[model samples]
Target: MAIWHWIEQTLRSYPELAIFLALAVGYWIGGKKFGSFSLGSVTGTLLAGVIIGQIGIDISPHIKSVFFIMFLFAVGFGVGPQFVRGVANDGLPQAVFAVIVSCLCLFSVYLAAVLSGYGPGLAAGLLAGTQTISASIGLATDAINRLDMSADQIQAQLDAIPVAYAVTYLFGTVGTGWIIAYLGPKILRINLQEECARYEKEMSEGEPDGGMQSAWYQYIVRSFKLTKPDFIAGKTVAQAEAGMTGGERLFLENLRRNGKIIEFDANTVLQVGDVVAVSGRHETLVDWSNRAEEVADQELLQIPIESIDVVVTSKNANGKTLLELSKSPCARGVYVTRIRRGSMGVDIPVQAQTKLHRGDIVSVSGSRKHVESVIEEFGFADRPTSVTDMVFVGSGIVIGGLIGAIVVPVGGIPITLSTSGGALIAGLVFGWLRSFKPKLGSVPSATLWFMNSVGLNVFIAVVGITAGPTFIQGVKEVGIELFFWGLFATSLPMLLAPLIGKYIFRFDPAINLGCCGGARTSTASVAMVAEAAKSNVPMLGYTVPYAISNTFLTLWGMVIVLLLG
Candidate 1:
């Protein structure tokens, strides 16, 4: 009994430890898979925090706010490039679809609240639940505070929010995942794998492995022997490569003559009986090999070849792409093996169309000479570093907080972004700016992941603990009405999302589901959808809409609360 009391005392005295425990437990639980469905970290952490909070281990709101702001900024920073690309001309339609889906979610919340005789708090909770956006809970609460009400009435309204949110959000997360993963394909009447294959065939590119994000990093190496009817013979390497067209333009990496490998240059001309090695996309290299006299042995071509990660610091490669650089004469001797954008996400395949940003650590493979050529054309090779740029990160947060402090009037209500939102906005600008000038910010990928994942979990863990006191009582008061309202809210927007996306906008089935997930701001659902599709093709539609909807839906949560609550 003494030991138990001491442990409880320790937990209460240092709530940060308790909060971290919840995160660790929740993350572990979230990773456990049951067949096709898995409870994700976000949901798992919230529940874990709730249980811990119910025990009397709780942190201050200020700590929660700090973590929340950190999370928003990292998210904004990461999505900066995608957000910019999505709003452009070619990407405009997907953005519109996402917006429409968000509006639909807003309408569904209003319709659900009005029909159910729910108050402003419940109404706002319905919106947050249906969208599966946890940020909405805070935004909705903020909006309620701005309303003109008696102290007792305000307290009552504020008290109603968490119960309704707590009930609906759980289903909101799981149900959205199920709908996109299972129900989406049934509605469209298509096999997801087949559809993705078709899309790949149309593009003439290699297939995506699950949702690796991009195919640009997918590469292959093949060796060819020079012979008669070979344009490469007696011609300079650059000139020979330039003569090839389409996917046949392979990067010449090595040349073997007289049982020895010789140095190559732009002026180094190929000779008969000389075997040369080329590296590029599998499809490109395969086709290039077919046009050769004979495919040589792999051993000679493999000599002294190495892969190195290069940092894109040169202004020339900042706005360009791996595909463009791959096609350039300088890139003919090397293959861009993979890309790590801002140290986040798995290395995406090198696709031709994916834009290059400054500071992107790109993996290129070839001989020392060819690698140097690629480095000269793009930027410098990456240096090893585990340390994060603290100065840059702190500055971004401060700037974001300042930005969030600015207020704007909407129908004379005096609206303003919370510190988190403002920081997110600032992070977006900082990230985008970093793409142009590689030296500006240096938040390591590992650090960004920590800020994004752990930060969000910590914020929600605090919320769950804080809400734990009134949680059960609130649920009982609302009865099952909140659950049904959540069901209605969750189901309606999804049903309408794909229907409108497909028939009205003519989005591909894979893309339509992605748009639906994005509009609802359900990243978990998007992941499931991409998994079901067996391709990252859906991501082409998901990213822009996800960015647009995340910002809008979070705002709408407050907007609906202000108008109807």
Candidate 2:
């Protein structure tokens, strides 16, 4: 009894301890599985905060704003490049589909809220929970605070937001997954795996690695002695490579003549006793007996080699296909292992004809010198680093805040974007600019993830704790009707997703499901669909839509609140 009393007193005296406790316990709860459905950390953290808040702990509202702004900025930064691409390029179909879905989501929630006679705060909570766009909660909160109401009324509305969110988030997470993964496939009436295979086959412009099955080492390097005089002995490196007949191309990186390693190029002549280091698919390199004897030339094979991810930024490489790039002199000694495109940077099916976009990241491997040259020719090398450029981030937030603070009175009603909205817009611009000028605004993926996840979770934890005192009462007031309304709002737009993708966008069956999953901004739904289809092909259509939907859904939070208010 003494220990319990001491612990309670400590938590009360130092309320910050409660926040960390809620976070730890909340993450643990979120990680647990409840029969194929698990509450994510956001929902879990919010609930934990609410439970902990029952101790009547009072935390400053400013804490919530700080964390919320950080999260909004991170989100905008992460999706900025893709958002711009979706708007300006061939991703327009998927972008349009996502916009329609987002609009429908807003309308559905508004309709549900109005029908249920809910206030703006409750409506915002429903929108956030049903869409599973946790960022919307911040927007809604900002909108509610802007309303002309008494302090007590404002607190009442603020307290009601979390109650509605906690109740509806369960269905929002699991229901969206079911509709996209299972229901959408059922509506299409096509075997997912077969359709995916067909689509993949159609997309493959050339037989990858000579139609060879993927081996442990798809790209490998081997040293061979030029023993066959009739084969490659008298030919120049370029001439010798020209004589080879196969789907896969090999590049010679080093040559050892007179027992000394020398850098060789296309025009370099080959001698009978020279040992050459060749890089290509393992399958293609396995048949070296016909041209030369395999040799373990340590000095020749042990040259400096590297694999780096290069973000495509050069106009010379943009819109070009892999096959086209491969023919360039700059690509002679480098091998592209993967092409990562779209918003999320997930690897798409890379073939000879896969086209390159300005921001696509191409993973290439070769001799260090060769790789560096390719990196220069292609775009910026995203070298592994732990440092983040804080100057750019700080400046963007300040500028965005200034921009957002501008108010334009429409018919005597003062309207402003609020600082949060400005931060989001600023993040987008900064993130996009970073793609063009890689040296500036370098927010590494790790730092961005921290800012995105911890920032949002911490803000939510504060919101939960603050609302905890009124939570039970808020739930009781909102009643069971809120849950049903959430279901209605969550289901309506998701159901329309597939139909819109197919009939309007005319997307492939696999891509249709992918776009639907992305439109809902549900990673779990896309993962489940990929599992069901037995391919990552669905992810091909995911990135652009995900980027588009994520941006708009977050903004809808403010819009819904304004309409309801």
**Model 1, residue 561: displacement in angstroms?**
2.9
Q: Per-candidate TM vs. native?
A: 0.78, 0.90
Question: What tens digits encode model 2's per-residue C-alpha lDDT throughout 60-127?
Answer: 88888888888888888888878887888888899999999999999999999888889988998898
Candidate 1, 458-558: lDDT as tens digits: 87777677666667788887859879888988888787777788788898775678778777777678778777777776655666677777767877867
After superposition, the stretches of candidate 1 with alpha carbons farther than 4 Å from their true spots are: 55-58, 119-121, 141-161, 189-193, 205-304, 308-326, 336-364, 368-384
In model 2, the runs with Cα more than 4 Å from the true position are: 212-250, 262-275, 278-296, 319-329, 332-347, 351-354
What's the lDDT for residue 111 in model 1? 85
lDDT (Cα, 0-100) at 458 in candidate 1:
84
In TM-score terms, candidate 1 sits at: 0.78
